[model samples]
Target: MSYKKVSLIVLGSEAALKRALITVIIGGDEAAKSSYLKESEIYENNNYKIIYTPDLNKPSKDIKSVFVYNKDHDRSLLVVKEGFSTGEVWKQIEELHKLTGKSTEEFIVVLPLIHEHTESYPFTCLKISNLFSTISKMAEDRRQKATSTSHADHPDDPMKVAGKPSDSRVNLVLLGMSGSGKSASGNTILGKTIFPSKASSSPVTAECQAEDKEIGSSWVRVIDTPDIFDDDINDFTKKQHVNKCKELSEHGSTVYLLVMHVSRFTDGERNILRKLGEAFGSKVHEQTLILFTRENDLMQGDMTQGAFIHSLTPDLKKIVTKCDNRCVWFENKAPSSGQVERLMHVVHQMLIFRNNSAGSWWRFSR
Candidate 1:
């Protein structure tokens, strides 16, 4: 008895598959070229051939070989071939699945996008290696997501899950007066020019907005709130914005950054800490850190940061003491990663202190 080799039936029109095949063959070495020809021949003869069909065609004979479908139809097997130099492959896969409006199988593979002009083996190997790395990372992410979802579906406790929280996210809320560099501070924290900042008497950020970013094993979620305590804004609107900030804090622990300009300290700021305690709980001071913007002013005055902060006005010093002397300075004109890193260090310390202290929760007004 003789056995015939099984060929893969790619789910696509013969013409389309052929064009893709030619592209790949032209880009590969002699060995890969020969393999392509052999695979193509197998598709030509149904005897031991691969089949290329636009749809899943019903056949009289039983073909036990692998069939590649052009589009995912909730199939058990899938091989996603993608080639792009930029963006994320994981994101692209998700987008395609959503665009198709179909649930896809977990069994998947990703092939690199081959360049037709490339002939060097070293370059080709590097490309293949990158593709495999991306696929592996995607697989690991999927596994973690599945595990988390499983635990979420079957909760063992009312307040917490059985396992430790997998989220390594930190929420930083920017709170300050109008034109106090709060919006600019938000952009600095996020390392992006998202929040609009300009010279205006009115608040630049009228509503609470959030942006997320990752920083070395931790995800930093930056929330920019309006000048809620501004006298110009009514109590009703202030409460609404405050509530929005609280909502964003639901997913993770919160660190409030009370932004203030280095050069400009208005009368309103004199009672800011007291008002903050009234708005949030009395313990709000523990979660709040004073962030002084416009470090350039200190430089211009030829004053060291420590001396400048130490020489703050009586009211400002009192507010800093209320926050346990936790403060950071940023140059809104020249934002730097160093400033952000220093701030994150302070944030990390606060989180540790909170975790260690019992019955210490971020005080957010209901």
Candidate 2:
């Protein structure tokens, strides 16, 4: 999706900005609303949200959530929250990981809200301007794919609704052991030459590379990372690789795109998840979904991935179960046109899983 639609967005802690916006929320003066609305124009209507905030923390929840939110008609929005401290946010998140398991980036956006009419709030002008500036930059870098890429699954209807996502800035991290075509899959998603690839242990990609491209109406970022199972690497070297990739993704990635060649899902392959847990924490697997590549190999080979992963592959199924039965097949050589859209659909559904479980903690595992 093109970010052109949203010119600005503010994400931050509400409690932090509480003292400043309290007066404005309580007074409910028309001038205050008018001022905040005008500032929204500066950002092309940037959306701002106070993450995990208590309704009472600020001067008023209804006063701000419903009123100030509408004043800024630009792409801007004020997100009032139900919780207060960072502890509350993490508590909800940890529980979420428990039930549905944590995805790549659990939460997509966090916006901090600020209001005008802050002459007596001491640093009202400075605080409001700073918060507005921060969100405005984020909003301007945004765009949503306005169209959907759907194929008619049935011959009866030509306009059958295929899977589509609301926001496409979603970044998927292709992680796993070496020689998994993680880089090749990166190339496929990008539809261009970006990351280096070859059948060698050189680890050409010793770091993470974040690249954005327009796919239909959404902007997709395919982050290529160094091998999680680099044998020749030292402990610090592995940490560096993980850190670099995490930074490139800028913490926006919500899906762990595990790209293992369908031909390589062996008992040994099952052990690889351990490295992921080790590298990104055990909870990492909870947010992951296996992305099997070289799908064409399944047809050409004597045995298919599904057939190979029978009762004997309890470990493989264990990994799948950790991620809420989410998985996808991709043919890097001849990728199905719907592959990207399908993966995104899975991502969209994974996001919705959080909403389904309520705005509280959920669990994963036995």
Candidate 3:
């Protein structure tokens, strides 16, 4: 498709932004491109133009500016900073979807990287296919007459919809019972040793700590928090941790990974459900997923992790089933641990499923 006007959204202001409509806003290392730019080997390609910026306030002046995605028939993708809020950001999308006047499914909104991935960003192909495919479909849907494709009209592109989701950020959180490898899981997700944690410890996490990151070309933030029910603390301390978790999770918590130890099921683990009920609600359990830690447990015993769960007491089975049986195992025993992308993919799917659900649709319809 011939295009005259195309905008790329970026997180910062730059000389390169004048050429695009928006700057999909990947927040890692645009300045360091000098290494490759010196060699004239800068890898810059995308289905949609990208304006590079360090923040959201600096998109180009001419193209429409939307801080959030909201509407009907609003067929566009939104690239956001890590830890984006579906509840907070969806207003713009809800508004745009209303404009499209189509079922929520007819127009799709996707957050490709749930966090900032520096190792693979700026020049990486991570999840870009799905992201671009949505834009391509939008462009196809809005394709105009083939005869007059001029700068004045800016060839009828469907991806040129009023508002779209941003792809510049990722949101990942670490949650599990005390001593269930929550901190290590966080470190693994972040690809750094940012937090202090140990296995088989009680109440190591006192509060939530967040660190921004770049996963490849995407921005990600990991928030590691205190154990679900730290018995060591008083009720006041408990409320504080609970409040902090809620505050931190206010945005872009696409999945609730209830990390549990494969070898043992403790009251601490059961307490997590009650705390989740308070933090997010009983419904949160339905959205919650089980992440089994300690890979060695599987190898150390005849009863494999899967078999152990299978032989669980009826109550445990019910508990697992309530969480939709969405579980994955991670061996955090080593760095570059298991199931990072798989975990992210699960979160991504949950966010998409959440968007398509009735609560979101009703907001637009109402």
On TM-score, the leading prediction is 1
Query: Distance (Å) between predicted and true CA of 58, model 2?
Result: 45
Evaluated at residue 180, the lDDT of candidate 3 is: 80
lDDT of each: 0.57, 0.51, 0.50
Expressed as tens digits, the lDDT of each residue in 1-366 for candidate 1 is 122322333332134333343222121112222123223322322112333333222331211222222232222212223333323433433443454443333323223322222332211122222332333344345445545343345354322333325354688999999888988888887777989889997667888998777653356788998887778778888788888888877777788999998898899988887778777778898898889998998999998766776688898888877786777789877887667766775676576545343112211100
- All candidates' TM-scores? 0.53, 0.49, 0.50
Prediction-by-prediction clash tally: 5, 41, 71
Off by over 4 Å in 1: 1-167, 355-366
Which stretches of model 2 miss by more than 4 angstroms? 1-168, 266-268, 301-312, 355-366
User: Per-residue lDDT tens digits of candidate 2, residues 1-366?
Assistant: 433333222322453333223222221121222223321211122223321223332343322343344433232222324333444544444433343333314322222211222233211112222333444345434422433445345433211213233232567788877788888888887877788877895556777787766554335678888775766678888888888777765534457888777666654467777878887777886568778788787678665444544432577777766665566677877876566655654554455443343211111111
Evaluate residue 185 in candidate 1 and report its C-alpha lDDT on the 0 to 100 scale: 88
Winner by lDDT: 1
TM-score head-to-head 1 vs 3, winner: 1
Residue 284 displacement in candidate 3 (angstroms): 1.7
